[model samples]
Target: MSKAEIQTTGFFTEREFTCWRERDYKNFYPCQVSKQEGNYVSLSLGDMSYRFDDTIAEDIARCILDADLVTAGKLYGYIPKPAMRESAFDSWYKMNSSGVWNYFGEGEFSYYRSGGVIIFMERVTDEDDTAEIMGIYTIDDVGIKLVLESSSYSFSKLDAVWLSNALMEALGEEPLDFLKTSTM
Candidate 1:
């Protein structure tokens, strides 16, 4: 039997959205392009779902940032080679979060803190390309920040595609081509 080296505590992945239904002010949704409405972003995970106007770029950023880790871990778990998980860990840890900007439309950023998990999403109001992502470390109030560990642009891009598709699949829906654009 394979043992999970990663300890289980209050930490959760985006896939664990089902278990968070009872929690107040907590979100477990995934990001996706919406088909029911034009220029909208649909975030769906398990049975819980949220739809937002494309104009709310900050919300979209939160969804994307929040789901990145879970998606990366899932991808690493699927590789066929030995020690692949470790490789994924190293690659993920090597990513730099310096340029990351979580612009929340000129001081409109928000965070969700619950069950030892913290997600920070900020977006610059004028800049369309920059967003900041900050997440709490999975220990007992050590106050460690999760650094971006995406080794390369390709890695980040791959993870984004996986996230978009995973969210769509989890919703029992087909993936759409273009996600709604936002400027928040």
Candidate 2:
């Protein structure tokens, strides 16, 4: 009935509590992060959390045993910068009246998967129509294709779920209920 409330802990009470974030305000959804005993950092989206180890490799772990531990932007690729989105409507809305056209148009995104299966999305709106649009594609040996549903993949169900959750968060879509997937 109401907006969902985010949970926090004494470990996350400070403004310094958030995970890696994009500098722009409208850039990305701010998923929460957690760490304990300096072992790993978990970037969580709803019930799905991706664990990234914070410790160095065992081969070099002993080299910094006595040094003061610090968080020197240690979380980068593990928590990437949110994908940026832009639209022609944004430019026109900016160039036109600000009062009545404040929220006049909807996004028209172009979603495509790269050769490596990495997804990329871009806004290509051309009108002020309040029509929302998006596309979903499956990447396979045949390359990108519009499929009804994506079920099978070369990766595990757990990785699939994590990627789904991350993309949803990045695109500002609702997080699906398939949160707990087995690592099998």
Candidate 3:
């Protein structure tokens, strides 16, 4: 067995390079962002040598465009923030470690379609060792649930995997796996 080397090259700023390195899991993930002819940007993720398909690359580009549009308040319904997990965990931690002693425990989350409504289901354990299931209703029925696996504050690999899968399923396509392994 051998360890993979990590390196980056391109017209990337320090902040952009840092963000890309943080998102790299195996210590070697290449992130390329190029400006296209129009109001579009081209992005790629993986080892520098890996050749991504044009269609998949286009999908990535489109996802970026849609996200920019959504963030600019031009799109409606569920326009998920790129750092949703981070945001979620931040709120979770804040609620857990406030002026009082409340721990955000863990449980399961499931989502599906029913009656033309998009619903979010969550089960979380509180400080008192009690589990509660909560439901979230959204304007658009995306038919996906964002589940919080554990509330122990120490996030696990399984939690990360599940969240990744859930979010990809919701996004209709596998997004560029760009996230750092950090709480909040």
Top lDDT: which candidate number? 1
Q: lDDT tens digits, residues 97-117, model 1?
A: 542222111123233433432
Residues 33-65, candidate 2: write the lDDT tens digits: 343344433344333333333321110111111
lDDT of each: 0.31, 0.26, 0.27
Regarding lDDT, does 1 or 3 come out ahead?
Answer: 1
Ten consecutive residues with minimal summed lDDT in candidate 1? 136-145
Full candidate order by TM-score, most accurate first: 1, 3, 2
Residue ranges of candidate 3 with Cα displaced over 4 Å: 1-30, 33-50, 74-184
> Judged by lDDT against the true structure, how good is candidate 3?
0.27
Error of 1 at 95 (Å): 12
TM-score of 3: 0.21
Q: How close is candidate 2 to the true structure, as a TM-score?
A: 0.20
TM-score of each: 0.24, 0.20, 0.21
Residue pairs clashing in model 3 are 105-151
Q: What TM-score does model 1 achieve against the real structure? A: 0.24
Query: How many clashes (backbone N, Cα, C below 3 Å) per candidate?
Result: 14, 0, 1
Candidate 1 — which residues are off by over 4 angstroms? 1-33, 57-160, 164-184
Name the regions of candidate 2 deviating beyond 4 angstroms.
1-122, 127-135, 138-157, 168-174
lDDT of 3 at 48: 23
